[model samples]
Target: MPQAFPIFPLLSYDSRKNSMTEARNWADKKTLGGRGHFDLQSSPASLVLDSVRAGDEGLYRCRVDFKKSPTRNARTNLTVIIPPHAPTILTKEEGQPVWTMVGPYNEGESLTLTCQVDGGKPTPRVVWLMNGEVVDEKSETQGPQRVTNTLTLEKLTRSHLHAALVCQASNNNHSTPVQTIINIEMNCEFYVGFSCLKDNKRGMDKF
Candidate 1:
């Protein structure tokens, strides 16, 4: 009778694991030939790794054994990586954002606030938010380090006074996220409208 090769237990790394130190096992328990499994069968001698992440960098071995047989094995390692998304604002930057009237904008002229974040790997994604909700606009990224995210609110009525604006810079690769916020004044004075009304009233009674 031909003697069967043995199974050997080894270590492996799975980036998706809940804990970094946690190890996983993957090997074909039964082999076609008691002698050993050649590279022919992808199952018994092969493993397919998906979404390989940075944490997956480590060593692994294949453990094999047969009834009343000695143990034999092989070794393989894997590495998984995920790329960066974009950069966004975490909190109010250095300067206090300024707002002003434009083109006789009595209703607190629509102003623009641009935020920039520096440094990230594989670049990052830029997004703008209002009171924790994402603002609807075309988000764009530029340069190697700085990413610019802008928020444009058209015809901001008095309802949006003292609105909270936030900028979120995202790079899914990193464990901790980055973000920024701005307590923007989105309201205009009603006095401007009241003055206009007074002027129109004063000029009336001619026809």
Candidate 2:
């Protein structure tokens, strides 16, 4: 006579909740159904994720317990790929778009431009471009998924006038980049010498 094998109970570990749920009940409210986008299958016992999102990333463990026998378990990390959000470009001084004409900017003055992205999984890389030329600089992580990149112009010059400045944010998961562009403009004074001459003439007349 052939011996009968005892059936084992299947379980799944929810790393986000730090709890274990029966395989058949893996989609219960306390497990993944509350958040949706997840499902469990029997026969070979598999987990299915639909329309995955960044918040759904984490380590998932599967276990089986047999009566009068040792337990078996396996774990796999799930990473959801998401593209970065559109980047925002602004002047460091006013926190507004560099194209906004608030006031005149003098030549030879240092200016800072910042590019930021609100969210992305695994963070995103920001790159600055001047007239389509890449500006080699480092970017800082503001939060878990927020990132900022800064570019400094040591001296504003006539050549920078009408120049296009662009910021692009990207990640390995997506080839398309989120970007923003701004055109530069300089102060209106055409000749400093002419202004100085007018000032000197006023001083002579007062004497």
Candidate 3:
């Protein structure tokens, strides 16, 4: 006479119950309706995920039960990394807010600007660059999602006129850094008959 074997359903670890719970009785499509991202099959006994998001990052445990064999369990830790949004440049002139362009500032005047970005799984880092060289970078976390960096150029001179000031932000190396560019404009001076004439330098914005 042959002995009978009882069938068992596949299960998932339930943290609340501290035990295994049946997960759709091993491949019941209707049980997983509305969650199109999950795929559980019998042949390979694997779970697939699609279009993952930051909210899906966490610890997961799967348990498999068999009719005539020992149970199997697996654990996984998922981490989702999201890129940051484009940085924005902001400043003020004479107590008024300014964006993109900061001035027709007089020569030897001080200039200050702030770069800000929001949204990323890991907080983004903001930096300031001038002429392809890093000039200043001071970052602060306003909360879990926002980041800001400020740069100040004290005593702007004729050499700083039309210079490209770049504000860049990035949280990961896999993606290109988001950046904003602004140009520094200053008063230009000319000599005519021993008299110094001053005029505002004007042109297209530099990258």
Best-matching candidate per TM-score: 3
lDDT of 1 by residue, 81-194 (tens): 344433333323343433331222336456466766666554566677776777744555677666676666677677666666666665665555576555645436654332
- Tell me the tens digit of each residue's lDDT in model 3 across 3-47: 222143222323333333443333433433323333334565556
Candidate 3 is scored at a TM of 0.67
Each candidate structure's TM-score, on Cα atoms with residue i matched to residue i, is: 0.42, 0.57, 0.67
The segments of candidate 2 whose C-alpha lies over 4 angstroms from its true place after superposition are: 1-48, 61-74, 97-106, 188-207
Once superposed on the true structure, which residue ranges of model 1 sit more than 4 Å away at CA? 1-108, 190-207
Clashing pairs in 3: none
- lDDT score for candidate 2 against the true structure: 0.68
Candidate 1: 10-residue stretch with minimal lDDT: 31-40
Measured on C-alpha atoms, candidate 3 has an lDDT of: 0.71
Q: Where's the lowest-lDDT run of ten residues in candidate 3? A: 4-13
Put down candidate 2 lDDT per residue, 28-94, tens digits, no spaces: 4444444553343465646665566666676666665665679877777877867788887777887
lDDT of each: 0.52, 0.68, 0.71
Ten-residue region with minimum lDDT total, candidate 2? 2-11
- Candidate 2 residue pairs in backbone clash: none
